[model samples]
Every structure is written in structure tokens, then in C-alpha cells.
Target: MTAEIDRRSILQVIGIGGGIAFLAGCGAGRTEPAQTEGTSAGISFRDQQGRTITFERPVTSVVTIPMPAASLLVAVDGGADHLAAMHNASWVAMRDGILGTMFPQALELPHEIATQDFTPNVESVRALNPDVVIQWSDAQLVAPLENAGLKVIGLVNNGKQEDVDAWIAMFSAMLGKPERATEIKDHSDRELAEVKELAAGRSGPGPSILYFNRFVGGLKAAAAKTYNDFYIKLIGGSNPATGEDPLPGTGMVGLDVEQVLSWDPEVILLGNFDGAMPQDVYDDPVWKNVAAVRSRRVYKVPLGGYRWDPPGQESPLMWHWLGDIAFPQEQSGLRGKTTDYYRMLYNYRPTNADLDRILWTEQNRQSADYQQFNAG
Candidate 1:
């Protein structure tokens, strides 16, 4: 078993240091904040510290301080269009498929700004004159941005229900898109309801699910309540680490080897994101003794839109992905049939070529390690 990753390492993995360090620039406020016309559509939220904050209109001239926040904003609207700069340049590169042909402007962002680290050239962000800047819960740093007279929104990507709902609702309300907020809330409610309905009276101890991610020499399973764990539950699967500490947004906890062997999950859904397949693990002697491996119930989670990123209201696609992987009999061409799901959930359909292009890009995921995650 490998040792679990520490908080510092996790930050590094997300690209907060070294070559992706912050760039120097002036901190003077460049743009004035504007209030939206109406109040009916606005939503008020209390932050983790319990201060009331109001969102009156959609944020314009957005700056993506972190990668996950960038993905979330993009899902809500053309955040990339508002993005004056970013911390991760890799996300914009053509090879990554995150910026894509549609958002060519994203590629033009200043080179000094990359990744989510605050180390980027401050001058670039100041020059863009953004109305809002999105960052994580780092209060100390976020305070300075607020002091600079920038409206800062903190996003939680840990995947907890409370955190997720608040993030979505607040953003939607602030963006003056109550319809979009309602859309996300409705979809989330439906998915949770369906999960409860399907799991009702299913009998026996529930199937165990774990998220295997690279750590020391092997892999570590995320705790329950992490986004990975939440997604499993959203699809009617169970994670044995229900009693573990909660990770916001993601709803995940750390799992040690001993704990994994103790739970000995019957059904394993290996993320295997970086070209690591379930078969690869099952073929190895180490995993052969696991119940899931022996039963041949271990499966690979797809790396497309549904897998790596927060499906957001886009969770309807999660159902399709789950059905294809866990219940192939129900696949019914849903994976390839983009129209119905796209329309029902997102209320729009990409051209067949759009669908084809998206799927095709996924085929060559290994060409770049960040490609799958950056695809949102």
C-alpha cells in the first residue's frame, strides 16, 4: 500500500507552485462593480464563515483563479468568454481540448498567467479589468483581492450537496439566471430522488465503491462524501467509507490499504484515468485477491465529460455513463445518442459533428495527461 498524499502535495498536483508560480503586476482596481437591475432573481448565501453575500447579476469579465472553478463557470455559461486570464495555460492549449475551437479567445490570454496559483503576473489580471474573480476558500489571499475592490466568489469543488447547491445557486442568482439555477436544482433533485427510489429495498449490504487514484507506489481510494463518492451514490452505488470525514464538493475521504482490504468491495469502479484500466489492475497479482477482481466486477470509469469533471446539471449524462458501464443492457445507444439527453438536460444539442468531435478527442486522451480533466 502507498502512503496517502498530504495537503501540500495535493496543492502541487493542482499546480500552485514552481513554474506555474504567480506573476507580478499592479494590484490597483481597474473596473468598477455594477449592480443588476432587479432583485427578484438574486440569491443570498452565507459563506463558510456565515457572512451574508448577495448575487444580483451574472459575473462578467470573470477571472478563473483555479481550475475547478473555471470548469464550473464554463458549465454555467461562456465563462471562458469572460475569463480575462487563468492560472493554468495547459487548460487552454489545443492539445488539451479544454479551450477547443469554439473558445479561441481563451488561448490568447497572457502567458504569465497559468494554473491556479496567485503567483501569476498581477498586472495581467489588473489589465483585463474583470468584474469578478473566482478562487477557492483561501481567505487570507481572497481578502486582498476583495481589498483591491474586486468581487470575489469562492467555489467549492469537493462535491458535497450543501456546497454544490450553494455554489450553483449563488452563481446562477448572481448571474441573473434564475432559470439556470432552477434547472440545476431540479436536475440534482431528480437524480437524488431516482437514486433513492432505485436503492429502496434492494436488500443485502450495499455494493461498495472506491475511487482509486495514484499515490505513493500504488493507489489510494478517496473517502465517502467526495465528488467521486457522491457520483457513485448518485447512480445508486454505495461507498463503504460512509463514516469517514467529509470532503466538500467531492465528498471524498482518504482510504488506507488496511481499510480497503477490510471493506473488500464487491464492485470496483476504477477511475484509471491516466490510461490505467481495470484489466491492468486485475491482471496484476496484488489486486487478484480483492473480491471485485476475482468476481470480474471491476470496471473502468469513462474519462469523457461525465467522469473527470463535475457533471453539474449535466448529471443526466452521468446516468448515461453509469448505465453503459454498470448496466450495459440499458445502454440503448445513449452514449452515442447525444440529442435526447442533451435536449432534456441542457436544452441544447451540439451538431452531430460536435458530438463526433468531442468523442474523438476523448479517444486520444493519453496524448496529454491534463486533457481529460481540462475537457469540460
Candidate 2:
């Protein structure tokens, strides 16, 4: 939290150390933060923090300090025209992830607005002259930015499915696209429901799944009540990581080597946050006896507009990816859904190679049931 990621490298630094070291609870922000006033014509509304913000006219420019907000802004606004500046971590998400492909101009935008821990770079953000600043609701984070007289749209996400809806609604309203917000919600609802419906069909207890937000520094698992665990349980899978103590506000907990062996999850998922990959786990003798490793069922979560491990615009896709392996019996259209999702949201379809990259095909091809994701 004390460090500042250098802005020159184009996403070399991630806010939580690497891939969203922070929790999505493993789902999208569960509720909406910013709300539109009266009708489509209203200019006043409350943010998730319940603070009222009234714009004299339309919002023409925005500075986003939260990591996911930048890509989300591009997604709801359908372009990069309104974004003035973003956090360095946000830049890494797009430049290294699929959002960069959808909006290349975003890659060139200024990302010196905040430090790695989301401390607002008041001078830089002020110079950007944005109409409003979108940031997290943490008092420590929001106080300085607000103290500078910046009209901040502070967001609070609880990692619920409604959180993603609220984000789409908030961004759409900010963009003056009420219809677009409805479209985004409908799409999210349809897909999320589809995954849930299919997951409900399975009768038996699903495989024991474990997700590691970070693996190299030590073992960190997505504990219960987090977005990560939410999706795991939502998809009918069991999370052995729940019930243990979690680091407050972060939504994950640390575990000793013996603790992991005790759970011995049937399927292991490597988060995009850390440098650890399938090979790292495969090579580690400590994990060899684990059921997931023995069965070769470990996988690296996919990264789309935002890291799939945490909630973002592409969260439903994360569910399908999990279903592809954990419930291999299902005819999960991993490829088609991704292609269709991109087309529906960005109006740009991905090629087979692009889908392959998003799904980590090259790295996960050898994992058990991974072939289920192949273009069939």
C-alpha cells in the first residue's frame, strides 16, 4: 500500500501486488454505487456511499482511480472519449487483458491519477480537469480526493450480483444511455441466470474447488462470503476455503501447508493476480499429493475486460469457464459464449486465437477436461 507503480511501463504494476490481489468476493461489485436522479433527464443522484452529486450540465470528462472502473467506463460509454485519467493498475488490466483489444485508444490514456494503493494523485487528477472523479468509498482513499474539492463519485461494492447491475446502470447513466444500461442488465441477467440454471441441474455435491488469489508468497485462498467464493458456491461447487479467518476488508485468508493438504481440493484454480501458473503448482512437490494436482484439474482463471477471478463486466464468462472443467458433463459453450459476449457488449467479435488467449488454452490445455472448451 505504500508503493507507487511507475506510470511509464504501461501496466507493469498491479494495485494488489499483481492480478487483483483484492477480492471481488469473486463476483462483480454486488451492488450499484452511483445512482441517477429522477428520470433520464435528471442530473442529480446518489452514489453507493449515498452522497449526492449534482452536475450543472452533462458530464463530459471523468477520472477513474478504481482499477475496474476504467475498463467499465469504456464498456458502458462504448469508447474512451470521456476518460481523462486512470490508475496505473487499471492500465495494466486493459493493456495486458482483453479490454485493450476492444479499445486501443484507452491504452494511450494517462494513468497517473492515483498510486498503486489508490491514493489519489491530487495534482495530476486536478490537472486532468475531469468533470467528476470515480473512486472507491473507503474513507482513507476518498478523503484526500474529496478534500481537494474534487466531485468524487464514491462507489461501494458488496460483491453481489446486483453490484454488477448497479455498476452497469451507474456507468450507463453517467454516459446518458439509459437504454444501454437496460441492455447491459438484460444481458448480464440472462447469462448469469443461464449459468445458475445449468448449475442447479446437477444433483450430487460438486467437486471440492479451491481458489488461490496468490500462491507464491504463501497460500491465500478466497474465503467464504467473498465474490470468488460466491461464484464457486453459485456454480454448485464446494469451496474448502470457507469458515477460516479472512484478512479484514480483503475477502481472503492465508493458510499453512498442512491446512491445504487437509482440504485437498478436487479442483484447483490459479487466480490471474499472481505470477504462479499451472507449471509452478505442477513442479511443486508439496502439492503433488493433492487431489487437484493428482487429477490434473488445476486451471488459471480467464481474464476479459477485467480479471475474471474478480467481478467485472465479463463475470458470467468466468462462471462458464469454471463449469467447463468442474462440471465437464455439461456442454459448456465456452468458445461461442465468449465470442457472442464480446459481440454483444463491444460490437467486436473475437477470433478463435483471441478466445484461446482469453481462456489460457496454451497454458491449460493439458489439464483434465480442458478439451471441453475447445471449438467443437
Candidate 3:
């Protein structure tokens, strides 16, 4: 068992901030170092943030700070045996999703290495003696851990589909299992190509869909360069929020009731980052008049190994789910595809009830489009 660190007690003195310390490997168009006897020989790879990371010893244990990195590791490495600690949100996602059931040890791993917003708790991280820590590119988040003598493989904080692919590629390379990433990418590529063909065949432009990034405290919609925007456009749907500009340091923009009313999207998507649901949209008096709410087009994004909303291993599934809703004419067997994916990735087939939970079948059952995904 890993020793527990007093995370709350140590933060005051630990002094944390962010920066990636480049250890070894070529820099910007430089030639790869020749394999020499005395130096330039170790586990070396460039992280997604384009920083080169090299370790003299094998990475037997890892601390994944980014929310989805932990699950990505489990998928790429084929188990959670190498995980030392992960972010709290990552732990929660695992606990609630199928990964926790498949790799129970991960649920017991500590999440005290980083705080709620991914700030590194330097002392807490040091206690675990992880071989490497997967971190984000935020300077405040990476600097502190580097100062504490931890090696960070920095990844960018973005929701693009390529970013998800980059994560799989980077992690699999780091684990000395590059083939795993190739397999994952191949599956994703095949599905993405299929979805694109379906989109091209659609007769008219798809419905206008609005993605609520946050609806509990205030309304924020995904717009421009977000992964939501990528898929919304891919599935033949147009983002009504395309013109809504995002404020600095975020990918989404703010809105109010009247603003949303003006757009009057044909479909509304509630993200998995919060607890807001389709029922919440349906129950709201002010929202009752909206075309999507009135038509029961609002839906809560599904959660499987991770929340299928943002970006992760199950994006192909998310694309199909969204496509089915926005263009039911092209609906396929999502339940069977999900079963096949699980068998290939986790080596375990989900039960009908598991599929229901993963697909949000019960909560979304009211929507006619959701019935096609039901297992039973």
C-alpha cells in the first residue's frame, strides 16, 4: 500500500506553481540524439505540450493529475496497476463508471496529489514517489511539482478530438506499449470515418444544437474550437452558439434566458461536468417555451469509463449517440457497438443494466430518440 500524505496540512508550506522541466530529447527540429554508451540513452518521449521527458529508470508507478489521464492510462496500459494517485474528479469518474468495476484497485488510489482545480500539492505528491506525474500545461499547476523534484509529462488542456488521440499516443509510448495507442486510434479513426460518411449523406443541414457547459449557476454554451463544436459540426448539426464568443481562459461563453430564446436551438445537450439533467430543463418554467425543451430534445450526456461529454476514450460512442439524436435516419446499433468496444478494451462485456447506466437509458427514456439505444 502507498503511504498516505497529509495533503491539507502540507499545502501551506509546500509552495506550488507550474513549469515543465525538460530532461532530454531533441528540441525544435533538432536531430535525434545518437544512442551512446555514456549518455542520451533512456526512456524518452515528447509529451503533448511538446516538452521532451526522459527517465533513467522504468516508470513503474505514475501519478495522473489531469481528469481523464488516469482513465486514459488504464485504457492504454490495459490496467491500473501502474497508477499511484490521480485527480479527485478522475477518481469520481472511475468510481461511477465501468473502469472502477474493472480495475477496483484504482478506486482505492489516493487523489491528494492535486487539488480540485489541478493545483499540485507538492508535498503530498512527493510522498508517493511516483516515477512520473502526468500534468497539464498550466504554469501554476506544473511549476510547483517540478520544484518538488517530480517529473511532469505536460499535456495541453483542450477538448479537440486530436488532443484525446495525442493523450493515448503519449501515454502508450511512455508505458512502452505504443501498439495499444495504435489499436485505440485505429478504432477511433474507423468510427470517425464512418460517422463522416453518414454526415455527408444527410440531405439537409442538421438541427441547431446548444451544448450547456454549465447551467446550474448560470448558462454557458460550448462554442468555437471546443470539442463540442467539432462534433456538432461533424454530425451535420450547426452550433447556434457558434457566434457566442468565449471569455479568456475558457472554451465556453455566457448567456441568459432571452439570449437562448433568440437562438431557440432544436436540441439541447447538458454536459456531464455537472448534475443538471433533461428533467431540469423540462421542469424550468422559463425554459418551457424553448423549442428543444418543448420537443424533449434536451439530454444529459452519458458517462462510461469517463464522461463522454468532454473528450476521452469513448468519444466515438458519444459521436454516434449525438448523431442518432440529431439525425435519427442514420441510427445504428449503439448497444452492440458498446459491447464490442468493452470486450476489446476492458476485456469485459457490460450487462444490459450497465449499458442502461452508461447510456443514461432510464433518465433519457422519455425522449423518443433514446429508445433506439436501450438494451432491453
Candidate 4:
């Protein structure tokens, strides 16, 4: 661990707001000094906010701020080894290794910084002196790092297409790993292509779904186009509040009783929080009148993987879950086949346990049956 000066230079770095330092790659085989007065020597690319961010070469001493952003990095290069630090300190040390075990190249990188939000560690970040920092949609966080004389870039991994693509591309541009980025993006695109082809001609009665989970308050629905919506769309399901605009960053879609009654979807799906499902909805006279309850079409989505939480970028678990719902024939050890699919698509092999752990976890299993509403 390199200890840096806590003097004015450190203070000067964080004093300015929104002024991020950037790098330019100097090409392979040429050793150049790390820092120049203004910019680095390498390639430049446009970031999601349409700002021009340049890199001096594949960034080695790197820090990842958000949990979702880390996947894009890992997708681009063998990101695990290059990571000098991360902001998702809660589970990165424990679960990331297990997840990284799925990829042969993504080795364990020791963290230089701790804390889930990265807010408490300016002095610590300065001490580690990472070459670049990657954050997914926290500009407020960026301002402080920019002030600290660090190169900070933004990534979007909150389950939106635009964000996912931009973040992946940014990683490609910064790491000199365009090929890897393209490979992953292409694989994602291809998966959707198959999904589209499957749904192109057929229009089935949309499965009514709900995503109620334990929040700080009571239960809440996952908003549209959020990771929830992404998987729902992939599996050809319908959210009861389908037409409402999705909230940014949070992806929450607010719903009330009238909205649920108006949609009257046939199926209801709930997130398994604390191993408890809202079965009382069937007993409630008002909810029993709803179509889903009357028709006895309700299901529970399994909750597993870092329990007591929703599934997002951290778990590839959702894909298997979606596949189970979308294409049953593909479900018999499909993730094992995913290893081959990745090899065919990405030229990388995924281990069996990686596929298994990602698939059959408690997070993937809900209650054995939907407690039919049976109102009428």
C-alpha cells in the first residue's frame, strides 16, 4: 500500500468541484509518464453524458464506485485483477470472488477502499492513488473525486439499455478492450434477438406480475425498465402498471388499488422477502375480487443470493429465472449450456458450479404454488 501525502495537494484535488482528471492511452509497448499537466496520451471516447473522456492506456490502478458498474469493467477486460478498489464493500470481498469464479480470467483484486457509497474515503482514496474511478450514475460522488484530482467516468448499469451500452463502451474505450466489450454487447443483443423472434408472431394473454418486496416501509413494486422490467420484458410478462413512466435511477412504478383493478392481469408474481409472500391478498375481500386472485394465477419469485434483497447486476441469477419462465425446454441445466453459449459467443468458458450457483439458488425459487385469490 502506497501512502500518499495528506498535504495541500490532496486537499487541492478535492477543493474543485466537477473537474475530473482524464488520461490518454500511449499505445502498447511504449512506457510513458503517468501524469502530464493537462491530459494523458491515448484514445478518446464520448461518455453517456456526451462528454469526451480519454484514457492513456488500459487503466490498471482502478477503483469501481457502484456495484452495477463493476460488471461492465469485468465484461471488458479481465477486470478483477485490475481493480485496486471498489465502493460496494459490503459483499465485494465475499460474493464477488464466487461470481468471478464463473469467469476464468476475472481474478480476485484486493480492495484499497471500503464503504458501500464511497463517501467516507477521500483520504483513503488519495492514499491508494488509483489511476481511474468508475461510477454508475452518481454525479454528486463524481464532483468530490474530480476535486481530488482523479479521473472519474460514469457508467449506467441500472438495467436500462442505453446505460448498459454506454457504460460497456466507456469501459472498452478506457481499457483498450473494444473487442471484449463488443463481444459482451453482441451476446446481450443476440439473446434479445432470440427473445424477439420467439415473441414476434405470437401474442398470448400477458401474465400479470407484481414485484412487492420489503422496503424500509412496507412492500413496494419495482419500477419500470428497472432491472425488474428488463427481466419481465425478457420473459414476455406484463407489469400491472405498464403505461406509467419509469422513475430514473430508482426505476420505481407506483401503483394503487384502482390501477390494479383496471389492469386485472391474470397472474400475480411477488418477490419472496423474508420467506414471506402476501398470501392474505387472497383472503382480502377487495383483492379477491381482482382477476388474478379470482383466476388462481399467482406465483412467487425465488429470493436468494445475498438474501433480503432484490436481484440486479450482482446476480446473473435472473437470466435462469427468466429462462425458466420464458422457455421451459431451455431450463434443464440451461446455465450449464450458458457456459457453451458464452464460449461460442465470448470465447470464454464458465464453470458448472458457476452456472448452478447462479441458477438454483433460493432467490430463484418461490413458494411451490400461487395462493389463488378465488374472489368470485
Candidate 5:
């Protein structure tokens, strides 16, 4: 069942912002420590913006402004010990979800720094006295933090698999744990290889998927070049909205009810952001005619240490789960793989109840535990 298609080649062909080639290995060489005033050790790497950044010493104390970045920090560092502060969103997920279940100590860490919306409070961050600040690669955001005399590193996780690998490598180097980075990358590569094999077994075109983000004024769908869109492609699912142009900068497009009906996707995946659930879609009159709803093929994307739909350390596990959802007959061992992943990475074997919560299964949807977990 091994895929004849080279995974890296396929990724480049479908890469966002045109085909950016996947690097063969970690780029940006390291250099000897120079006599810089503040830096104890010298390390350099290329960031997502293709800018080279050098650190004086290993980033021991960190403030991750973005929720996803917090997850990455904890994962690559092998624990939450180095995290001085993190976005509130990651803290919430950690408290009520599998993160807390695995690493209860993370609950004790200070996560009061308010930067979940990408707006950093300099006073609040300065109080934490972090050695480095990790956030999304936005110049405007980086400038003010620099002005405040804080060392900041920018990262972009736009759903490209190669980029995720690069991030693991870059963060590992920054944390002075190149061995850990290699371990993480090797695990991810192995998992992706498994997914490719499963995808190769499928006969016809994969299921037509629509990743519904929210139901605000209209249906906001993940468009081409978006993270969710890239995930769909990675898992061998076809996005019905691919032909439509993405919204400027954001990579999400708004689709009216009629347009969604016209696309009539075979499978619908609800994003974990908004509180919208499968019941809402099933109950809506306009949505009733959609093929996915009519066939009972709509599913809620799982949320664990982080949202499975986003770019994070849990992406390998995400690929396994999505592969099962996309081709259950061929990739039916998601639970076993999930068990191995949690045990290996988080050092906690999830209970049956935890699996239900993480998977967002129908049984979980009917239970009070799920309600309480979401309410928190």
C-alpha cells in the first residue's frame, strides 16, 4: 500500500504561495559563540520569514504569545518547566482537556500573560522576565516587543508539513536540544509515512471535504492555501472550495448557503474554534440538503493538547486520526496509534474516557462529561 507518489514532491506541488521546496535538512548553520555583551552562547537559524536570527544563549525562559506556539514549546522542551507564561487559550485547553490529564503540573504554571489575540501587554510580559518571546511571524508584533527590549523569535505554522518539521528543528536548536528535535522529526516522518501508505490503498478520489470554521453571518470555510485546506490535502481529501479564491491575507473565504449547497461536499469537518456542533448543522434547514449532512458524514475535529485542526506538536497524531476518518476501512487503528503517541510523547496513557473526549465521538457527545469539559 506504499504510495508511489513522493510525499515531499506532492507537498511542494500543492504548497501555499506557490511551490516552496521542502528543505533537505535543517537549514541555517550554527556558529561559535562570539563575545556579545548579553549572549553566553551563539546559535543561528532561519525563521519562517527567511530571516536569520542569532541567540546569545539557549532560550531558557520563554513567553509563547500564540496558543499553538505554547504547545510546541512544551512538546520540544519535553515539559512545561521552561515556560514562564503562555497565552490563556492554551492554558484553558490544558486545564480542562488531555493536557491537564497528562501533565497536571502545567496547570500550576503562570499563564496570565494576555496575548492570545496577538496583542502583547509589555508590562505583563516584562513582569514574567522571559529570556525570549515566541510568537507568530508578524513584523508589527515583533517591532513593539523589540522596542520593549525583549528578545523575540518569529515562527509561522501555515499548515505546510515541511514547515512543521522545520519548526520542530528550529525550536529544538533554540532550546539546545538538537537530539530531541531529531527524535520528534523522526517520529513525525514515520507517522506521515504510515498515512501515505493508507492513502495509497484508496481506489477512487478521496472524499470531498468542507472544513467549516464558523457560522457567524454566513458559513466561513477554509479556502485554498489555508492550514485546514492543507490538512485536507495531506489526508487525501479533496476540498470542494479549492477553485474559489481565498480571502485576502486570512486564507478563509465566506460561502453563502447556496454556494455550500452547490458544492455539496461529501464530508464536513467542523473547526474547534466556534461552539458550533454537528447537531447545529444537522438541524439547520439550509444545511439539511448538503450531502454530508444527509449522509451523516459530518464530524467535529478533535481537541487534545491543542486543536487537531491547527499546526502544533500534535500534528502527527492529527494525521493518524484524520486518516482514519477519511478512510476508516484502510486506516482503522487510530485508537491504538493514539495510545502509543500519548504514552510516548506525553508519558500518559489516556483512559477510555479520555479517548472519547479527545476523539469527540458520538458517545462523548451524549455524555455529561463532554458538556462539562467544553463548558470549562
Candidate 6:
């Protein structure tokens, strides 16, 4: 909760006050006037599933059943003032990370809409009287909420870079905050462009990386065309798990020790799920032969406002961090970029220790703070 200047500077550069005027001057003929606070014409737009939805008026109250939906809403809507309730996953992620630190008021909101397994409770959602409900594109889950007479907007979050722009556009239109959406989109575009430019300077193929969450049940990796694979490609690294068929609807494919050894990835990125630590990988005898472990290139993905593995507001930050890790010789300005993003978006100026906490690695997993954050 310390980076107001960074946020102000972003606004100043974007000319936020004149953003609408600039759009008007673009000469892009529109079919309808943009929705505003009290427009009688109401709001209408197509959601991610290609369903046309029209509202009688601008939405002031919202309930999000998916964690990413809440994260995107918070980014475009500024804070959680409009959120009536959220999924339990979103509640926990926000409570323990930069989102809660910056917007403590969000902690006071109710989170009784769904359970950890994503089972929605209709009665609990009805009690909140939300203007709309945002969730995944699952028909069965969404049908019940719609039957309860709530406006339901379905989004398919596949974690691609394109999904980021789509979320910004969808939420901006729904909340009647096009200006904020433009600002967020512009910021993401600028950061990603810089990272892409850095990648262009590389003379050879990037390192091979494998991103996985758990190793107990089986080795599940982010396969090609999935959300996590999108990040791997963005960082200029290649995913060895690509081309293999992913588990149905899960976007992950199974791997065995022998298969992993064959791929011989130079880097391994452990997802910040289930309190996984890099030490867990290093200690396993079967993994000792992997090139990543031998070279000490294994690292834990960072978790800030949200987990970096998925498409959320903090994705651009992840791009910068991964680029620097993959090719340090290019100097991707990782620290400066991370500091600016935290200040501008989360309104929190990270101290050196705070940076360490956000970018928790295997070396610091035993610290009291890291333990507390992952204790859940």
C-alpha cells in the first residue's frame, strides 16, 4: 500500500482524463454510444462464449464464481467495492497476497458463493442480491444462477495472452469503465512489446522448460495450446511437453521420469500450487538426472496479486520475470519492472524483503513469512 505515485504517473502518461476524447477523435464510427453511469439505452455486449447479453442499466453489484473473474474485475473496476461475493479460491488468493495488502477493504466482503471444489450454492448467492454473476462457461453451473434470475456472463479463461485483452474488454464494457480498461490494456501491451523486443535479440533457441504443479499423483505438465503453455512461449522458451494430448478439459498432460529425462529440459518451473517448493524436486532421486536440477535452473513461479501460472492481471509481470530468468545476458530489467508494476497496480511499494517474499525461491522457503503465506 505504498505506490500512489506510480499509479499517478501511469495515468499521466496515458492521458487518462482525455482518454475518451482521444477515442472519439479516432473517427472509428460506432453503432452505439458508449455506456455511461445513467444511460437509458442500457448496456449490451457479447461475452466470451459468443452470447449476446443486454442489461437494462449499468451493473453496480457483481458476484464472481471464478477466481480469475474476480481478479480481472478488481483490475478493471479499480477495487472490490462493487463485488458482493466471490468464490472461495479468489477469497484465499486475495487475502494472502498483494491484492489484500493493497485493498484491505476487500477482505471485509463475503465469500460464500462457492466451495474449493467449485460447487456453487444458490441460496448463498441469492442472499447477496447481486446485479450480475460472472463465472466460467460451464453450462450446468451457470444455468442454475440464471434460473435464480441473475444476469450471468460466461468467460472461457484459457490463459492465452489474447485472453488478457478479452477480459479487459469484457469487464470494461460490463462495468461501464472503458477508460480503466484502456489503461490496463495499454500497460499490458507496452510491457509485452518490450519483452518481445528483448526476445528478438536472442541468437539461438531459448531453453527448454517444463511447468508442473504436482509430482505425487503423476507428473502433470502444461501442454501446448493450454494457458500455461502460452506463458512458456511468451518467455521465448519451448515446452517439451507440447504436441502430447492433454487430459480432458484440464489442459495438462502426464509425464514419467523416463520421458522427462529424454526431453532433458534445461529449466523447470514449479507452479505455486499445493505449497509446492523447489526443494521437493531437488530431493527426489529420480529427478536428479534432469538437466535443470543438475544446473540449478529450477525455480518456483511467483505469486503476487494472483498466481502467475494463469492469465490474470499480473501476467505482464510474469513475462518480464521469466524473460530475465531465461536469458540474463539481455538484462530484461526484472527488478525495476516488478517494482513499477507492484506500485502502479497493487499500490504497494515492495521493499527488498517484500520483493523476496513475492518472488519466493527455494533458498527462502524456510523463512517465517514464506511459511505463513503458504501455510494454507
Error of 3 at 4 (Å): 35
Ranking 4 against 5 by TM-score, winner: 5
RMSD of each: 11.3, 8.7, 8.6, 11.3, 8.5, 8.2
For every model shown, what is its TM-score relative to the native structure?
Answer: 0.65, 0.87, 0.86, 0.65, 0.81, 0.81
lDDT of 4 by residue, 233-296 (tens): 6566666544453332345544566656776756565654323343556656877777767865
Ten-residue stretch with the least lDDT total in model 1: 6-15
Residue 287 Cα positional deviation in candidate 4, in Å, after optimal superposition:
9.8
List lDDT for all candidates, in order. Answer: 0.49, 0.73, 0.76, 0.49, 0.68, 0.67
Query: lDDT tens string, model 6, 118-202?
Result: 6579888888888888877677778888888877887655545655666667677667666666777788999888888877867
Off by over 4 Å in 6: 1-40, 243-250, 361-376
- Cα lDDT tens digits, model 2, 1-376, are 1011111100010122111111111113232232223432335544555555555455779999877788788777878889888888788878878888888888888987777778888989887878899988788888887888888887655545655665665666556565666777778888788888988787888888899988989888877556787788888888887634333334667778788898888999998777778877888999999999999998988878778887778888888788777888786777988888788778888988788888888888878888777766
Ranking by lDDT: 3, 2, 5, 6, 4, 1
lDDT: worst 10-residue window of model 6 = 1-10
Measured by C-alpha RMSD in angstroms, how accurate is candidate 4?
11.3
> In terms of TM-score, which candidate is stronger, 3 or 5?
3
lDDT of 5 by residue, 308-353 (tens): 8777778887776666666656544666777787766667787777
Which regions of candidate 2 deviate over 4 angstroms? 1-42, 243-250
C-alpha positional error of residue 142 in candidate 5 after TM-score superposition, expressed in Å? 0.7
- For residues 134-198, what per-residue lDDT tens digits would candidate 3 score against the true structure? 98877777889899888898776345565677677667656766567678988998999999999
Query: Model 4's lDDT to the true fold?
Result: 0.49
